[model samples]
Structures are given as C-alpha cells and as structure tokens.
Target: MKNLGRVTPATALVLESLLSADSVWGLQIVKDTGKKPGTVYPILERLEAAGWVQGEWETSEERKGPRRRYYRLLADARPLARDFVRAQRSKASSAVRPTPAFNEGGWSAV
Candidate 1:
C-alpha cells in the first residue's frame, strides 16, 4: 500500500502476526500464514536486522521444551499498528491475501 521500502508484504504479515500474538517461533509463523519457511525466515532476519523485530531463545522447564527462537515486534513498530488499523478501516482490499510464505503441505507443527 504505502512505500514499504525493502520490506515486502510478507514481512508485514510476519510483523502483524507477531503484533497480534505475544511471541512466535519462525516455523509457527510459517504455519499460521501457510508460507514456506525458506521465504519466511529471511524476512524475519531482515526484520531483526532492521530493529523492527526481536528474537530470543526461549527456555522452559515445565514441559522440558527445547530452546526456541521467538519473535516480537520492537517498540518502534508498535505505533505503526495504529496507523495500519486506521488505514485498513477506510480502504477496502479483500483480495490482499497477505499471508506469510510457507510450504503448505510440507511440514507439521512441532
């Protein structure tokens, strides 16, 4: 819609998805958006490099879960959400199936 610069629509979906949730792993994002991880991970890396998102290893002992990298939108990108909402409220574009990239039938959620 607007000048997304180097960031593509896939990147936006990733950011928006994280903004909607607390934090999510690289693969879960793929599942949620039905996009290939090959495409999704790079976007995540770019987002992290741009400081728009942050990823960290998560450790949990309750279920003995392995370390997982979780991503969340940075503080700076938080304001953009409101602006996006305001813009979406007015303009109508339903064909925009702006989901993240992932291999739909290739992987199972772990």
Candidate 2:
C-alpha cells in the first residue's frame, strides 16, 4: 500500500464509515460521515490512490437511477485503517483536553 500521508479529521470519519460495510456507495459515505460531497470525494480518491481501497461502478438494470460508484477497503489496508482511526481519535481527544497556560505572572488553568 502506498503512503496515506496526512489524513484530516474529515478523511478519518470517512474511513471510519467504510469500516462498517463491506462496500459502500459515494452518497452513502457522505450520509454516514455527515460530510459534504467535496470533502468525501477527495478522501475516497486518496484512499483509492494509496491502494487502501478499490472503487467500481454499480450496474443494475433493475434499479432506475444514475450509476453509483462503490468503494471497498482493500484487505491489506484494514489493519492500517483501524490503527489510523484509533490514532486520530486519540489525537482529537487530546486536542480537546484542557491544558495549563503559562503567563508572566504564573501558570493558570486553560
């Protein structure tokens, strides 16, 4: 698998959503992650480029709608994705935690 480089919070959410299903359509991912199309599509693109995921068009004559592009996580990428999600969660929590602030006078709660 190629390097994923940097995964923003939105990208992390997309990866988390992908974990729940065997394969998912683009709109479904947007819905699951509560992210806009602009944000979701780029993350999917990166995952696909990194060999972490595979995407294909859905073709069903019985269904009457536009073709849906679906994505599935690569078997090799699962463990890496799990680790990434955990790390992102930990990083996010730490960012939200209060930290002490230092001033000229003294240290204070933040």
Candidate 3:
C-alpha cells in the first residue's frame, strides 16, 4: 500500500468503520461514522487510491436502491489501518480535556 499521507479525523473514523466489517457500503460507513457523504466518499476514494482499500460495485440485482459500492481494506493493509486508527484514537483521547469550571475570578481547569 502507498503512503496514506495525513490521516484526518474523518479518515480515521472511516477506517474504524471499515475495520468493523469484512466489507461495507459507502452509505453504511457514512451512517456509521455520522459523517457527511461529502466527507466519507472522498476518504474512501483516497483510501482506494492509496491501495489500502478496494471498492466493488454491488452486482446482485435483488437489492432495490442504486448500486452500492462496497469497500474493504486490502489484506496487507489491515494491520497498518489498525495502527493508524489506534494512534488517532490515542491522539483524540489525549487532546480532550474536561470543561473548565467558572471560578469567582475566571475559568479554572478544576
């Protein structure tokens, strides 16, 4: 797989969603991540371009709506995707801080 470059929070969310299943439809990922379609689609495209993901159009005619594109992480890239997701989660958790309480003078961490 090629370098994925900067992995944004949206991209991390997408990766997390993908890791949860063997294959996932793009819309399902959008719903799973609660991210906009605009945000999720591009990330999927980028992942596919980077060789980390493979997307295939649904061939079954039994389904109703528009043909859904199912995406799956390349076998060799799964471990790296997991590592990226873990790192992103670590950063996100570390970056979060409790809301500051208002003190008599000003705001305080306590």
Candidate 4:
C-alpha cells in the first residue's frame, strides 16, 4: 500500500502541489503545507529518493535571493494518487458501519 506507506497529510500537500503545477520551489511547498523548513526539507529528500518527485536548481531567470530547488512529480505518482482516491471512494461506498474504535471519550465493546 504505497499510498498508505509514507505519505502523511503534510507530504500529501506537497505532492498535490507538484501534481497541479509544472514545478514548485521548496519555499512554495513550505507555504502550502504551512510546515516549518525543518520538516519540509527532509520530506523532499525522501520523495526525491522514492522517485515520486524530481528536483532541480532554478536556472535562467534570477531572483532577488539565491535560486531555489524546483520540484515536479514523476509520471507514475499521479496515477497512484488517482487510484488511491478511487479505492478510498469504493471502500467508503461499501462500508458496513461506522468505525467502532475509540480513544479519548471511551472504548467500544469488543
């Protein structure tokens, strides 16, 4: 279950942005996810290693500051995310009852 494997909510936001745009910078992803620089960079490294994303230095156009690393998704990851969404919808449609597990309030009977 690659969908469930490593893509936490925060990582999913980064991936979604890459999917929508041609390429995005680290700072943009940081803005989109609202996570600190400390958290976002490590996740980018993991995604790049996993082949879900490819990153490169911004070239040609110069900015006020140093050029940033732009990220884009691999062709494969898009389908995986789509299929994952479909599977979740299918599961939801066929679900029998509400989840029984509980934590803070009280535990459900086994």
TM-score of each: 0.64, 0.85, 0.88, 0.67
Best by TM-score: 3
Task: Summarize candidate 2's per-residue lDDT along 17-108 as a digit string, tens digits.
Answer: 88989999999999999999999998999899989999999878788889999999988988888888898999998889678899997988
Q: Judging by TM-score, tell me the better candidate of 1 and 3.
A: 3
Tens digits of per-residue lDDT, candidate 4, 1-110, equal 13347456566666666667878899998888788988888888888887777899988575677889998877878877555445555666777566677778887733
Candidate 1 residue-wise lDDT, 1-110, digit = tens:
12335445566566667777878887899887677999889888876776777899877757565767899877777777546544554344664546554476764433
**For this target, which candidate reaches the highest lDDT against the unseen true structure?**
3
Lowest-sum lDDT 10-residue window in model 4: 1-10
lDDT of each: 0.70, 0.91, 0.94, 0.74
Q: Is candidate 2 or candidate 3 better by lDDT?
A: 3
Q: Model 2: clashing residue pairs? A: none
lDDT string, candidate 3, 1-110, tens digits = 89988899899999999999999999999999999999999999999999999999999999898999999988998898899999999999999988899989999886
Clashes of 4: 0
Which residue window of length 10 is worst by lDDT in model 3? 1-10
Ranked by lDDT, the better of candidates 2 and 4 is 2
CA lDDT, candidate 1, residue 74 = 72
RMSD, every candidate, angstroms: 12.7, 3.4, 2.2, 6.8
For model 3 the local lDDT of residue 90 reads 98
